[model samples]
Target: MMVQCVICDILEELDNTAPEAKRLRNRPIHTYMCAACHERVTARTNERIATGKFRFYRSSRRIEGDFYS
Candidate 1:
């Protein structure tokens, strides 16, 4: 299954077995806004990711583009 970002509707697959995945899965279904919207809502999301709240995986395309460009 996928979790859609509250602000942008970008879909991300959920991995329940992985360690990082487990942390997120165990938490409540909290709302996560897109980058821009997150800035307005609060600084929590950015802070969480920075502090290792959850492991993040970017889209393969984005990774490829970043390295190839």
Candidate 2:
């Protein structure tokens, strides 16, 4: 299957039976990022994390028992 990287907009080919190809075929919301762009992003993110000011926030899941009397 052929897919385009969302970041660089470069086209690349993937084997039709690959798990990633299957994901792109099955989900329209999922995005494709080429290896080069993925590595660039990872490196930049690691730099930010190393600065000690980067905060990674995640939603806290509430338990049902917490709300019960």
Candidate 3:
């Protein structure tokens, strides 16, 4: 199956029987990211987290309650 990376727009080929291919075929909302783009994003996110000022604005309500407790 042919899939395009949502981040880099690069085209990649996956085996027809691959689980990822099946997932993309069955679920339209899921997105694909190339390995390089994924790694880059991961590294940048870690950097931000290490800066001690990163905030997760979308944190769960349960976590917010726990924080105030």
Candidate 4:
């Protein structure tokens, strides 16, 4: 049996102006199913999450003083 892998994107909203839109615009959120396909969508989603590519950050703190001080 031959198995084929599919790629997809999961987003909250579909906005062309959105920053995420650019990256996932051309990608498919769902994968195609065919004979002998054992790949799970959940697995793929987990991989993406672990990569930090979909992380949300508000702000970062900085050290104003000198390191030696």
Candidate 5:
């Protein structure tokens, strides 16, 4: 399967049988990130974490539950 990196927009070919390729085929909202960009971002994020200033925000499942209740 042919996929493009969401960060760098580089075209890459993936094995059609690979799980990632299947995921992209099945989900339109899921994006593909090339290995290079993935590594770069990981390194940068690690650096920020080491500096003690990185913040990771996650959606609150508790808030959603409360809203439905």
Candidate 6:
């Protein structure tokens, strides 16, 4: 399947049998990213993480209760 990288806007090809290709075919909302862009972002994220400040906060609720029922 032919897909374009949202970051670099480059056109690329993927095997039709690949899971990623299947996902894109099944879900239009899913976007594609080229390997170069993915690697660049990963390196930058690692750099920030190494600086001791980057954090990923999710939606899980904190349990304030200390006693069990």
* Top-TM-score structure, candidate number: 2
RMSD of candidate 3 to the truth, in angstroms, is 4.3
Candidate numbers sorted by lDDT from highest down: 3, 5, 2, 6, 1, 4
Cα lDDT of model 6 by residue, 12-49, tens digit: 99999999999999999999999999999998987986
Residues 1-69, candidate 4: write the lDDT tens digits.
121234332222345665445544455574334323335655665687678675435533333123112
- Between candidates 5 and 6, the one scoring higher on lDDT is 5
Clashing pairs in 5: none
- What are the per-residue Cα lDDT tens digits for candidate 5 across 1-69? 889999999999999999999999999999999999999998887788679675545648776456435
Model 2 segments more than 4 A misplaced: 59-69
Q: Against the true structure, what is each candidate's TM-score? A: 0.32, 0.82, 0.75, 0.24, 0.80, 0.79
> lDDT values of the candidates?
0.61, 0.84, 0.86, 0.43, 0.86, 0.83
TM-score of 3: 0.75
lDDT winner, 4 or 6? 6
Candidate 3 per-residue lDDT over residues 1-69, each given as its tens digit: 888999889999999998988899999999988899999999898798779687678999888567545
Highest lDDT against the true fold, candidate: 3
How much is 30 displaced in model 2, in angstroms? Answer: 0.4
lDDT of 2 by residue, 1-69 (tens): 889999999999999999999999999999999999999999998788679786556533353234222
Q: Over 4 Å off in model 5, which ranges?
A: 59-69
Report the number of clashing residue pairs per model: 0, 0, 0, 2, 0, 0
Clashing pairs in 4: 8-28, 9-29
The per-residue C-alpha lDDT of model 4 at residue 23 equals 46
